[model samples]
Target chain A: MELVGISKLNADYEAAMAVRKGIKLFIDESAKENFKKAGIEVAGTKVEMISDSQIVIDATPDGIGAKNKALYVSMKKPAIFQGGEDADVAEASFSALCNYDEAKGKNYVRVVSCNTTGMLRVICTLKNSFKVRKIRAVLIRRAADPREVKKGPINSILLNPVELPSHHAVDIKTVLKDLDILTMAYVVPTTLMHVHALTVQVDGNPSKEEIINALESSRRILGISKDSKIASTAEIVETFRDMGRIRYDVPEVVFFEDSIHSSNGEIFLTYAVHQESIVVPENIDAVRAMSGLKEKEESISLTDSTLGLLRGRLV
Target chain B: MELVGISKLNADYEAAMAVRKGIKLFIDESAKENFKKAGIEVAGTKVEMISDSQIVIDATPDGIGAKNKALYVSMKKPAIFQGGEDADVAEASFSALCNYDEAKGKNYVRVVSCNTTGMLRVICTLKNSFKVRKIRAVLIRRAADPREVKKGPINSILLNPVELPSHHAVDIKTVLKDLDILTMAYVVPTTLMHVHALTVQVDGNPSKEEIINALESSRRILGISKDSKIASTAEIVETFRDMGRIRYDVPEVVFFEDSIHSSNGEIFLTYAVHQESIVVPENIDAVRAMSGLKEKEESISLTDSTLGLLRGRLV
Candidate 1:
């Protein structure tokens, strides 16, 4: 896979350089020396990369990727944009769980944001088994990635929009077009994981056991820490380390099994999603999906298997 | 106010005796020597504590409190039992926010359990704001008190009832008889606080701003960490410490402001209740109510004011 090394911010540049091994990264002439010093193999401009490659994954910082649309369209190559890009910027949105069928052979795909992706995974999984009426979620979001020190209030809690449903609900609509959801979001100071408190109302009042069984049987939805020992999200992060995951990336929604409660035909639960790698599996699925190389099931299974999804306490 | 501490477990005895400067304590003959060495004052027997007091607060173990019912009735002394006691054992169940008037002048009063107390506090506060149709909650419970090391699985998640709706729902019924609530409980290995994921469905679809306004206006619900810098419960605890709270105890439910979401007439949010001090103000209110010392508002205001509830980020 080729990378895009834009010598913009310190963090983005360093991130690209760190993962530059065995991949040809597109960079400007000014960043060639820095790339060489960092032992990174450099390629040509974004135009050249688009022309040479069969498909392009636009990971450039938000608006920049969307602005490069004309280049990809001129080359007639399939393009995949990161979640940061606007949904309208892409031809259609893709989540491995929600819209996998529609994603196949797509020329352009915008993978949903991390929170939307996590919610979609659970909602899509459960909607097949139960009659989902509505979804209400409160997102306890991390302020920034661990390395993004320059990107936070550092000590204050600020509400995005400070009113109404946050943009997350609107963003999710790009994938699950018909699903009714209302989301509230808050960015906390910590850079650990995003915790979501979700309430999903189904048609009939099911037993708690039934809800747990359904959620547990779902794909990529991990029922974690049912035992009394593993307590907080902090302990969960430690558990991920114990499992020896690459970069301690848990690519699934870590939900508390005992917290899955069904009453009056409604389900209430809490889950923590590791924001860093939650999108990695979906990105892999999108690649196969856009290339039309594999069917939905085959692509998901291959991606999950390659990412060690079924190996341990994770889904 | 006099405290009647009974010497039983080593920790309980030490706790009681350490604070026995002006208080009377009841102890068995076997533990009398330990109390004497600890420079604690020992009163007559359990019978004497029940006989001499204007109101006997039964702090005994669960079933034991019910077992001592005859002694309290024989003396015609009004008694208050902790939540561990059976609800039927008391003349009326009491929570500061719910049925405080009914609790007054009752000979036997049973305060709701910690989980029930916390739930009642929120439910009673919100019931009037909107016509609450149903409440679905997932209780992330603490395994034991911080000092009670021998009382937990230590590293295992244990589900109480292992089925739909734990005893908390039943207990809450003791207070809010008409409330439609379903609660599932799990004991995690942490003693910090009990976090609840709550979903409330009301009559007409209220706006997110309406819900936030209702909750913020309610008593003893602290909207904490409005800034991104104050992140997790750990940092919230640190904030409490910085505020110079006694033992860093936050008597109210600390909820993230940005996480309050309302859609389709349903509200979703998460809040952490400090288990240790959650009931402290209630106990004070209960005492005043039972003694006929003050009206409900007077008692609650006095209790809140005396506990420094109004001075900090709470109440």
Candidate 2:
């Protein structure tokens, strides 16, 4: 499959291509001359870029995706929307592990938010092996992304909704229809990652080893042991940087192996979710499902392998 | 009661008195000359300060309290220890609201830690009006005191104990002997306050107003309404500073009035504990309890009045 970028802004298009593989093409001599004068080569955009592409990934800012959906629908093109878009903006809220089949051949698929995506991977992975009952999660959320200067709590922990079961849990229920889950969230001063303290109850009593094995087997979950010395999100990002991960992006859900504790059919564990990149792989899989190009496992494996995720201890 | 500062270091003595009300007295000419040359009339410590004092407040560092126990015991002085000391170091681990009776007339009374003190005030207050069966609290802790530059996760949310029921719960249990409570803690990048998300199971189905009334009636717990516009820890400190509070200290537990929700014998609420000063009132009460100067209610009322706590909406 070929990839192309389209944005009203030339800089946005350039940024899109820089993160992926694409040839820098100049649309006009003026555009080329502008870059030459600045002593830098640049990429350019075309008016018919959307028309030329088979599918569109509406990666625009939040409400913008809903607006762009009209254009995509008018063109009769299948589009995948980011988590920012509301559920009504898409035919279905997508999670590759939870409901990839629901997105197959659909015109619009909205991959749930980063936290929702991270949770789906773990919950769905567990559901695949056990009769899951209920879950209570306390989300210690990052106040802002590292690049975000305007957004803040700066040195405060704010209750995101100041209420019970933040939107992420409700969002999860959008896909996993009957799952019993409740989430409480607090936004803390950190841009690295969001940490979740989860307590799950299942039908059968499972050993800690069995639970760990089930989670570890998932290509999208990276089980980190205590001995790794990659204790906090800072060390996780530092390890990713040391390992030469692009943008220090850890697309996989980081599960602390030592944090797993199971007793009397109840399991307790904690994991860190990279809010920026946890949904990237899900978006890739969503693209495949929307295009009807591959089966669920096939798409997930392809995306994981392409992104070099779950390649053992990241440290 | 007369207060005397007794620290081997004059600087430590000065800092202690600066926060409290005491006249600066120089013990030696050299010390007086040194302060005069520095353009400051500083308080000096006498070698006989401990012997001359009726009671001692051991504010030394953690294990140092245990070591200092030997000296206090040798001096035959009734002393009240800070939370830093172990339970074994004192005759009782005390929270004014929880175990003031047990601490009464005791020579060595250890005021529980800041977090424990915060929990005890709320729990004991609730236990006063209702039979609390169980409690599960998620403690979002401040990484360090604002004045401490040496301590940090800086930009990370660390699981204080990468396990369930962090030390705070265990510490709380030390005082509330048979109270069933489970606590989880994450240390975030904030030095202002520790936010607690508490879900308490009670024997009776109390109305939200009843619960709020019980909590507010406690002089040590300050109920903050949403209308006050004090949303997070930063705003709480700012409001205190605006109120001309000494050192911007909020010695009361700041409970969010709007965060309280009651359903089917369960109470869910969130409150902020100013880690620096939440225990100040408790410490004052502890001194009175240890010295047998006042009974439980009398000591608490006196301390609350002296600290100017629970006056009204701080904002």
Candidate 3:
């Protein structure tokens, strides 16, 4: 694994820096001096890194992945793109819960954005248990990462399009082609977590216990504190800190057991996705799926266990 | 406006103490000394408080309200009861959003609880804008009020029935006779707020803007900050603090403008009801309704304005 960047991050990059091994920085000449000064080793250029690696995860700034497609094509190696990249850069959008098969035997897979992944994790978990008639999701997104201090309208709330369905519904359709989804997206000032409030209308009446059981069955969904002790995302981050997570990152979807409500056939609930680590597991699973080294179930299970997804309470 | 209580509270009672006028404590001999020592004047027995007032608002504990009905009955004064009282104790349950008119000329009115009020606010707001076919709500309730440290399983999540459709649906029907609602209740350890996640299946495909406009039309609904600055409820409380609210209480339902998502007649979103202040506005409206001094519109408007409910962001 290699950490490839075009230049030195405007500020310290904690998420990338937290990786202690199997990571060599492939940065430009301008960033090389800063890397060495910071007591970090630097690898060759982006072109050399692409050729040397078995798999490339293009996590560069938005639109940059599409620009670097030629290098990956030259190597004929499997590459994964982050949400910031357009779907055109890859054959199909990837969500571990939505379309694992799409990633198999593929050279390019674009992992869906953080918000979309959270919605997929939830909708996919319950879709099999109940007949989903419709889905409406509200994405309360973080305006900027904690480190990106200069990036936002810190006081005002901006609604994208001031309309019904935002790009999220369109992005979700890239994988869940048949499902009907309407997404409303808003970027808030908070840099902590992105919260998705979802309502899925399913056919027939499902019991609350039934809905809880269905979600609990999913290994990827980690049930966080339902007890009020950890009420807000700030407290939730603190819980992760107290749990002694290496980078204080919760890669899995965190939901409240008490928040699960099923009435008649409709389900309503709220869940938080850590913008920093939600895609990390999907990236690992995509590697296995793209390499064709293991089956979907084995790959997902291996990713979940290795990532400590099962450490939290189930319900 | 009367602060008639059985005794001096063991802990600080911010809500009650915040009232500037028209409060009299009615406590027994045991706690009467504490009230006088705290420089508070004491009224006579429960019977005197019920008899002397033009209208009585019974803030007594559960079962105790039923027991004290004899006192209110003797005076024939219209009394408002909290949710803790049984249905038999009151003629009908009261929510400002639901059955406000029913409170008129009623001898006994029961104001719904905090969690119920939050759901009712959202449901009533939407029901008017769209034909609601079905509703499912999950109540992430506060285990105990901030003042009631003695009353809770503070570290554990408790499912009241360990099944579907807890008492909230049954209670909702007591006010809304035709609503098809199912509510699941769970108590979390946090004392800050009770969060309600609601999903409604409506008759037509409504746009997100239409749904948001409906809620914003209601003065009691306060759209809070969505940007990174005020991410958590802790910060929301601080926002109220900076605004110089009397009790640091948010009497209105705090939701996000970006959280309104509607597609194919289904709407989804999450909002937090400050457990300390949610019922306060309802209680105020209930008094006006019970006393028959004003119509429903005037009563609700007067309550909202007097409580500064219109001060927060509308959208």
The best candidate by lDDT is: 2
Which 10-residue window in model 1 chain A sums to the lowest lDDT? A2-11
Give the TM-score ranking, best first: 2, 1, 3
lDDT (tens digit, per residue) of candidate 2 on B1-315: 667754533434354455355554434344655545545445554436677788888777788888877877888988888887778888889888888889877898888888889888899999999999988788889999988889998899887777576878888988888987878788899888999988888987999889888987777788777777766888888888888988898888888777787877878888898888877787788888878899988888888777677743444
Q: Rank by lDDT, descending? A: 2, 1, 3
> Cα deviation in Å at residue A208, candidate 1?
7.4
Tens-digit lDDT track for model 3 on A1-315? 334433233214542463355455566556666666676655565566666678888777889889878878877877899988878889889998878988888999999988888778888888878889888676666667867869863533334433457788888889888888877655545677876656788999887678777777786776654555454566677778887987788887877666666665667776778888899989888888888978888888888877787534633
Ranking of all candidate structures by their DockQ, best first: 2, 1, 3
Best model number under TM-score: 2
DockQ each:
0.10, 0.61, 0.07
Where is the poorest 10-residue window by lDDT in model 2 chain A? A6-15
lDDT of 3 at A259: 61
lDDT of 3: 0.71
Winner on lDDT (1 vs 3):
1
Root-mean-square deviation of candidate 2: 3.4
Residue B307 shift from truth in candidate 1, angstroms: 3.8
Better of 2 and 3 by lDDT: 2
